[model samples]
Target: MREEKGVIIRTLQEDINNLKIEQASTLHQLSSTLSHLSSTLSQVADLQHEQNALRQELRKEQNQRLTIQEEVNRLKSKGCQCDNSSRNSTLLPHDIQTVKEAITFDLQLEMKQQNDSIMSEMSRMEKDVRDVKAKIRATAMTISGLVSSVSDLQTQIYFSAGTIRDVNKQWKTNEIIVFPHVLANVGGGYDASSGVFTVPKSGVYVLTCFLSTHSSSMYAKLILNGNPVVGITAVTNDVSDVDTGGNAMVSRFQQDDRIWIQFYIGHFLWTMSDASVSTFSGFLL
Candidate 1:
């Protein structure tokens, strides 16, 4: 009986140890699962934050689009001089008819006056046309005299050849030199260096300047007939890459009118200062 009791006590002790080991394993498994769940919760929170940010950005974009749409609607309304509210405004039928009739009456009176004026001008113009044709036919016999006379008036300045005389000088930066004198086809001389291209002709003329600056950061200025046409400027360092060459400007001129080109800021002048008389034959069309 004593041996049996000792054996029973040992069995009880072993069972208690086994139960303790199973409890410890269960605790460890629970800790691992809890850690995994915590990690999953963190990831989910991060996903939620990103989703919130995306929603905010979407809302901002939608607001901007709405603002742009409103501005476009306003501009469209102003351009058309009307809107939905104005179109929907109520008005009495008789009042609307009265306004329409008044407008129609004024339009008819204005149109009748216009027609009468147009008919009178047309009759006068027809008579002038007939007179001009008669004059042309009568002058046909004296065509040489007439041609020479018109040519004298039109050829105030002869720029047919050797009009632009390049000085062959390399114009450097901040240099204001005189251009060479060109013998006038009729009487005077043209000196571009002084910014003066004398028009010897009495008729109208078109003038132009072909100008360019050096590769250095610079801007050109074209002053023709005392009119200023500002050239393009190098805002950035790579501007030279965009436009290696310079700009040009043209202007119409009359007899004895002066034309020239200058620099806005002292820039590197290039090997190009050539001026040509554009046209000197036609009337001021």
Candidate 2:
């Protein structure tokens, strides 16, 4: 009976040790997960802070650009008016002839000399105005570019997916794909329902689109102003392993140009895992 009790105690002690070991291991895993979560949260906060700073900077630049543009228009309207006013300041002639003819001649000569001096001064002033107008034009072009860049920064848009959940679908050849879910749109240029991004101003842009395939061979292209700027093609045959292809381009766009994607004939885009991880992204370059 004593040996039996000893064996029972030893078994109980071993079970307690095993439980302790499992508890420690579980605690370690929880600690690691918490640490990783904290790091991810910190990174998210930093990204938010950086985005806010960029917004503020863009706003500041846009305001400054507006002020400069207004000045340019105003200066352009006031151009050459100074020269016209100078020409209109010339005095008329007088009607009198008598013993004061000598005095009249002297007065006429003096007036002519003064008028010549004024004309010379006006010419110099006009030259100065020309120089200023040139400077304003150069400044206007520079500021216009800056305004476009900042406006592009302010007018960003990204698409992730559509609202069509689990709907078996196929995009026909030359048909457009509309992403119903918009992740971000700075300006109202991007239409989520139509999946078209309209260019608000003329400038160069960097565009990227990702298309995922499940089983159908697919070829998609980014269409800008009814022309293909970039294209990608992919084919998937296995269900367990999916395939994805993407197209990117740095293309020049004009104002009011509509940008979207079109699938080629005999190709289709598919949904994988009940979620649309496919994305379309772009920014002004």
Model 2 worst lDDT run, 10 consecutive residues? 91-100
Deviation of model 2 at 195, angstroms: 1.2
Misplaced by over 4 Å in model 2 are 1-167, 239-241, 266-268, 272-275
Clash total of candidate 2: 0
Q: Against the true structure, candidate 1 has what lDDT?
A: 0.44
Poorest lDDT segment (10 consecutive residues) of candidate 1:
276-285
Q: How high is the lDDT of residue 79 in model 2?
A: 36
TM-score of 1: 0.32
| C-alpha lDDT (0 to 100) for residue 203 of candidate 2 | 74
Residue 219, model 2, lDDT: 83
Q: Model 1: runs farther than 4 Å from truth? A: 1-145, 148-178, 181-189, 229-252, 272-285
As a whole number from 0 to 100, the lDDT of residue 254 in candidate 2 is: 82
